[model samples]
Target chain A: MDRSVLSIIKCFGTELYNALKDAQDDISEIRIRKEKSVVVYKQNIPYAVTKQGLTALELDNAKNEYITVSEALIKDAFAQLCSYSVYRFQNDINNGFITVNGGHRIGICGTYVGENGIMRSVRDITSLNIRIAREYKGCSRKLADIAGCEGGILICGVPSTGKTTMLRDISRLFSTEKMLKVSVVDERGELSAYSHTSNGFDLGLCDIYCGYPKQKAVICAVRTMSPDFIVCDELTGEDIESVCFTVNYGVKMIASVHCDSLENGLKNVSLFRLLKTGAFNKVVFLNRSIIGKIDAVYNIGDIQKLYE
Target chain B: MNNMKIIGAVLIILTSWLTGIMLSKRLSQREELLIELKQLLSEIKRRITYEMPTMCDLISNCGTQYLKPFTDNMYNSLSGGYTINESVISAVADTPLLCVLQDCEKQLITDVLSSLGAADSTSVREITDSAIIQLDHYIGLAQENRQKNSKVYFVTSLYIGFAAVILMI
Candidate 1:
């Protein structure tokens, strides 16, 4: 077995042990099959396994709930598997999960722990999925011109609507092709695929302030990095107002958000609020078909016109 | 010449020679000790002030730069995507100041260490005590600044309650 691969497995095992220790008494046996995968079973029930070794989920009739392995747990395991990665569980336990590096994502699912209308932590989390995000070259070819234009563009789509993908591609275009000084406030590391102090995706000649709060990172980028354009993923929260206020700095913004339709995108209270501030000039809606095709782009103003 | 007179003359000459040699040795030793002390004190001061700060700057930059993306990701997850503007603004607001403070702390430590070096054993103990006092002062200042900043954020959020409502809507 390669030393590096073994080391990775060992790390994974340690992370799994830590995460599950509170729940499980002991990780009885860990078996690595074909030098590519590891399966961890407690008393031979197969509680969790790596993706490389994942097969069909076996049902345990005794357990009332479905016994399938969870994505969140797997993601946490994978993060531990990688040597250079850092894993942080956001203190906001209610809706928070774990963030690995700036690339891989593992969303948490469980009971919400709320405090006075704010989510504090997630309890009884059953599973987690680890998605490895990659940046493909030329992904932004279609959107380059629109993104590179002088004004800012807002990308709108529903949940799992590839909004982040489009934003990533646009950032690449602005940084690499247009030769613009781009600063990516990658709050989730989703947009830039930044991992291990090196970017998993080619952001061209861009500066990324990773791991800071998105609002702070964007402000910092504008003031210090001297970026001509700022790109960020998943714009939400009271910070949008600050973005509006800071537009006089002359740095343009490109960001993504979740909404179902063009009208929905514009009518979204947060989106509408941001729009009213005149912070963005263009809004593009992304539609993905059932067969996984990027269907169309709609202007927010046009949608509003139709609504009127 | 009488025996007693001769003996007295010899004693006087011997006493004078002994006294002169002793004085010369004492003065030379004192000069050497001063030179050694000065050289050590300067070297210590430079290490504390210049080299220490440089090392700290490197560490802070490396740590902040390394941690920034990770922390940003956490912030994003917590804020539920509404954190973009705040992300940039906070980064701008906090990092340079942190770098400056780190430099200041390094210089402070160096100053204390340099002072301690020139001190004798007893004085060294006294200097060490003084250095600890100085460190406590700076640490307190840092904590106070942090508290003040935290308060500012709290107040700002309170004032921006309307904006927050708009965002949630």
Candidate 2:
């Protein structure tokens, strides 16, 4: 396990840190709620974390024995996550999560405070769901040849199906191996996680723009970086115009969307509009059981035919 | 015997005069410290309002050496994994630069440090503004005390030394 990943959970204090330290390699997510048993997901399986270690017993049965999260722990962790500066992360807090070092995304649940019926920032934190980011180097080797093609690729999958890992690896491969100019617009800082204190993940010659909104980043990359391929994560409805603009500007895009099947993927208004742009030539769907294994691939023309 | 007595009298007067100067200089030093503290708080308020930087970044970028001890302790403690409140409290306690502050002034500084990053920009600004006002009050008091008592201390000590010397003679 990377030491930085373990260091992030240290804000919960020493007891939880010690219990999770040895099992951190397999840990995928940690869910913390005040006055609730601290549950950790190990390779997609939930296990209650006790003072001794991870327990296989169900949370309800072992509630007495499990290490319960406290309000103090949550407060301390929230402060630590903000780096002792609430004002600095107001936007991230308003968005309901903050990406910390090592690219771990902590989903914050709290009371929203605002004025005149407008939602502003979160306060009185009650729960935090930490999704641990893992990098599988060379995971996109199978898709490397397809990535070298002239057009773009759209990756689709349910949550935790290795969409991000594939995008990361493909970016690395194209930038370094194929000697192509790749621009990664990391909106949430997860893909690159680059910070002042950390170098984050090695994307192999990719020029990363961290924390830029996807649409803006695409335009900026097209104008400034002149990248052969513009890679980003999680395309939404607001990005359709920019996607078309970038595709018309003659830059290939590699991005991901949340979908289980090709039919369901087309149902997404934004993804459907994206396909209509003729930007991506192929849509790659990932399988859940196998992290990086591609479940299906379809040509864009075929998808367009199916949609019509 | 007359020469010895003259030398002794000169020595006593000189020693007492030096003591008086030292006492007056302490008052001046206290006043200067308060003034600097006020300036520091104002700078912090401006930065918090404009940049909203982390506490560590704020202190590191402050670029003033007068509060170096406090800043250094803050940086080390915050980096050492202490919570911001704990780090601020410990840093304030450890810094010798803050020693000149009276109980109320010290409490004021502690409140400022403790509340700096604990709230939103508006709230932090409000806290800092309040602290700065209190600091200004203290500065005024210190300045008044220095001006009023510095000469008193000097003259009283000098006269006492003179009286002792005359009696000895």
Best by DockQ: 2
Each prediction's total of clashing residue pairs, residues at least 3 apart in sequence or on different chains, is: 43, 0
Where does candidate 1 stray beyond 4 Å? A1-88, A92-95, A111-124, A146-148, A290-293, B1-169
Model 1 Cα lDDT, one tens digit per residue, A1-308: 22222333333345433333334333333432222233444433454442323233344334232222344444444333322111123331223444444354555555675668865445455544333344556655766655446777777666555566667777777777678888888776666656544546667777877666877887788779998878878778576755774587877788777666665655667876766555566776666432112455545465456656
Q: What global local distance difference test value does model 2 have?
A: 0.84
- List model 2 lDDT by residue over B88-125, tens digit each: 78988898867767888877777788777777777777
Which whole-number lDDT from 0 to 100 does residue A180 have in model 2?
A: 95
Residue B110 C-alpha lDDT in model 2? 75
RMSD of each: 22.0, 2.4
DockQ values for all predictions?
A: 0.02, 0.67
| lDDT of each residue in B93-128, candidate 1, tens digit only | 344422333555445434543333222233444554
The runs of at least 3 residues in candidate 2 whose Cα sits more than 4 Å from the true structure, single-residue gaps closed, are B1-12, B42-53, B63-66, B166-169
Please report the candidate that would top TM-score against the real structure: 2
Model 2 backbone overlap count: 0
